[model samples]
Target: MSYMDFPSFSLVGSFYTDPSTMDNDPSHYDESCTNPSPWQDPGGSHFFSFQDILASKPNRAFTPPVVTCAFDQNGNPSLTDPLIGAPVNSTDTPGATNGQTPPFSPAKMVDLDVYQQGVSNIYGFVLKLTVGGTVLTGAMDPCTLNSIRFDRVLPTRGWAGWDSYGWGSFGGDSNACGVYQSVVRIPADTWPAASGSPILDQLRAATTQDTSGNLLLSIRMTLDGYQNVPWHASDFRIGRVLATVGPQLATDPSHCLAGRWLAGRSAGPGDAWDQPSLYGAPFEVKNNTVAIDLSNALMTSAPGQGPLNLGNLSVYIGDGSTGVVGTPFQTNDILYSLSGGIVRLPLTAEQAAAAASAPFFLASSLPGINGLSTFNKQPVLWQESATGFWIACDDRNFQLASDQPNPGSQPGFFYVTQWGQPVTDASQIEHHVFPCFPNNSAATVPWSGGYKGNSLSSDGCLEAVLCPGTHSGQFCLELSAIWDPGSRTPELESQLYFICLWQKGTPPPPPNLESGCPPQEQMMSAVVWSSYQINTKPDWAEIQRLMKVYVKLFPSMHARMDLSDQQTFQIFSTNPPWFVSYANMPGPATYTLPSGGVIASGTIPYYMTRTIDDPRLMPIMRDLSPNRLLTVLYYCYNLQQETQPTPPPPGEGAPHPTATPTRKGANA
Candidate 1:
């Protein structure tokens, strides 16, 4: 939607009008209202004093279009005595009950009466309340040198119809009071800049006026009460304004901040975030903040750079002509170049309107977070604005585990979460998960190894749900990738339901959370992280032998293996693949290292977080997932360990308690 087209009376300011016609371009402008009106409007118009009009809290009986007071036949307004409950309009005025009258007693106090709440692309918008008129021609008392300075209104930014009180601009008589009226002429463009520039070179403001001659901006703030004009208010202030660089303030005065709130978006799949699809996916849009992986375009260790860190990359959006180089409007005039690649420069629609070129750039440091080494940083993907998400500055990490020591090793679930790994959303497993566990050398050719086999359907859960499966054993994958830079080794882990597999109707034995894998309680269980061999490739012959033997061992188990999923890029092609440390065996990659082979690229990195530990959640396992982990272990990977792993370190559960099959390639 063209968000600018949105209509709202949310802002207030002053504009210009032709004094001769008494018409204003921007209608409904009202202002400061400190005193009561004493002089008649002379035009015989309905009258309401400024202070009486705003006496109520707002949204009360005083519907604040505020009655205009009549000017005396001489144009001079008098502030003699305070007028109370003077017939505002013939039919309205709320009265206080219980004999408890309020100060200067307003008819009523409105509760959130006119301030509506809703999302708007437009932020930091300014408006006018009333347009003052200029002294075109008027009768006057003879002017002395002291009378030279008159109370005549003058034009602002040029427009006799809508003007400001000029300095030494008014002339003619001192008592000079004549018919006060002006022609209405709204600006062709509502924004200060008809072009809608993202950066404001200057403060755009307006002045509100009350019949008592008090001029205010008419800004409505919950706290600090209704401040008089000339004082810096939160939303519209001339002095130190109050505002956050983040999204629009939900409450009245949270963000009167100077920095603009920018948008974010994913550059593409080439910039895969290091975490697995199950969790820690670099892409997120929440609380008006956007986070997307930008590794492809800015990774220091990317193709040619060796061991170099970008040191908080900088990403940009907008024309870049007027904004200070490397500074986010969100920042209180702080320079971005000062922030190591951590802080993000948010781009807003206003900036877009005045953009000179495509506004897209990367940052080395994430915005807000500071003072940290970037070596172990999770492929830094701060706010990618297109989504309008908000990530607190203090919430970002300062340090992480170093490069993977053994890129092929599986670092159990316990170790993974211990180091503060990010978790992925479950529903996107197939689209965002699975591809991380591709077939290592066993597939004979890396080109076809990444999920291109004939045994199972060639899709993840996104397609798995579409593929026909046994009604009783249907399951979806839920797995995680744990990378411990201490070992420079990363392992893919899966859950174990083979231990709990039984006929659909019969309930399994009580879960043993103390030892072995946690109990699988639901029909649709998550894909527990598991691997065939921690650091080596499984032979196809050995895989076939294991699969055949398992099927023969449990003839009615109806186990199925899916091999095509091991193929990298089957679901999505991205740069800096999920495995940033390891090289692809014989697949597409930006760099091919003679020592490590291929660096996996062009994919997502993050797996879903398992909910086995939450006491309140006991999903019926049989209904949610397919019987696929075993088939995966037999045909695609080798089980990590024979005995159930015990302790804070996640060890593997036995393949089966009763059987030990023979395979020459098997270590056990």
Candidate 2:
């Protein structure tokens, strides 16, 4: 509906003469109350008060464009007043009980009787009380002993009249008295002629007089008591009529009826509560605080070839701008306006490419350890070997045998043929199997064989073997090329040999030659060296420094190694002076070798006691010594035993464990 052609009030024939004109003359009782006498008083009697008129004769008493007041019947004044000298028991009183004495004493006098009489006479012309089609007579004014008898007049039309009252006659002067007031009770015909007719029909015909004395038919309405008006009709419209005739307090806009022209529909899913949609269209209405879901909209004519092409296309809607277009898609793909509206764009090749190629990489580090060390310090290496070549050596002392008769007999090692191990030459051994031992036991050993010393150099061949120890049941081998310092040439290098065993028997054969191998070199520049003593562990700072250097060499590899010694507890009944010394000595000792490299040793002194038979100390010695003694035995065998002196017997000058100090070569 365009504003210019909007319907007007008169188009539907909803016009009527002012309500004031209807009640202009009250003297002509037989005619409709279209014109009441101007000299009549509009106040003084209860009828002059619109409230009393409504209470006395409710329903259609007053027509459209009527002023009304609400009154309480409970507060009505008495008809007789003994204090006023009006006969308290007089049967002549209009409302008195027949032949009965009044409730109050006759000696007292009340002024209300006179006052009510004056009000009734002055307002008699304007007020009318009706019951059904007939008007009652001799109805005593409840406010006084005065009698109010109406001329048996029946209203022909629906109530239509005016009201007036004289204050001077009722003992109040012009200043306090109201005069020349008019009211018109219009017939129900003045209502809307049709369902959708203009709402001003009853208002225009029934009431008149504006606050500015404009003489327009618009009524100054002030809504008060409950009037049985229809739901569609607004209280404001009714109030305007009353306000035009009398003073009225302005009402808040929110309190006004929800008119169609005043407010649009409430916010909802498809309403303008959100920003208007702007897609292949031109302009858009903006609205903040709204949300939109544009998952499945299509843009066909964009910078791409597909029918649902979403490509480079500048679109703006409600403070939002989109550079790319999207084709028919789900809620996620649909473009949303800045203010909150969904829009679809055509699909383009660029968008397709963007969706296809997303940069992602699989990144991982060594498991178990944390921080950067797991990534930087753990070493990973690959290798190649020749057939028949034994890649590892398993010493008999470090291996377990079923029987003691062959305790020293070697159980042979295996070749590396699995997990990235390849045999390229005739001397390259493909596979070899051997018994396994506990990984943590001193007897457990890794696969170790190198073709009998210089044979590796002569035959130009390589072999690998695995010894799966009992404790750790997995075998791992890594080999890398080491660079020759003088020739700057790469040669086959042994990186590491790891063996874990599940049972006592031989391990399975290695994989075929198709397995990959590491690059061959003389000496590997990158290597991770880590060691921990029985009592001392590397702190984070030391680990970090080592990790820094390790990362630089093996920029892309992880290297890790953990080492521990068996724990030993020694107790003495008579504490030795150097008990702390022996215990402290057991902690791992780190030192810088002559080669400018670092090494750690797991060794400690055995403290001696005068009373070695203490029962508590016995079990402690037993539990803490067995594994430690085994480790010491292995160390002694490897380095050629050079015993440390026994500790001096308490106060006896016996040799102390530290009495003897032995030093072995670098190999030890």
Best by lDDT: 1
Instruction: Name the TM-score of candidate 1.
Output: 0.18
Give per-residue CA lDDT, model 1, range 86-136, as digits (tens).
121111111122353312211111100001000001111121222222111
Each prediction's TM-score against the native? 0.18, 0.14
Q: Report lDDT per candidate.
A: 0.20, 0.19
The worst-scoring run of ten residues by lDDT in candidate 2 lies at 8-17
What is the per-residue lDDT of model 2 for residues 212-279, given as tens digits with 9 covering 90 to 100? 32212211111112212222122201111122111111110101110110000111132221111111
**For candidate 2, what's the RMSD?**
50.7
Q: What is the C-alpha RMSD of each candidate to the true structure, in Å?
A: 34.0, 50.7
Q: How many clashing residue pairs appear in each of the predictions shown? A: 157, 105
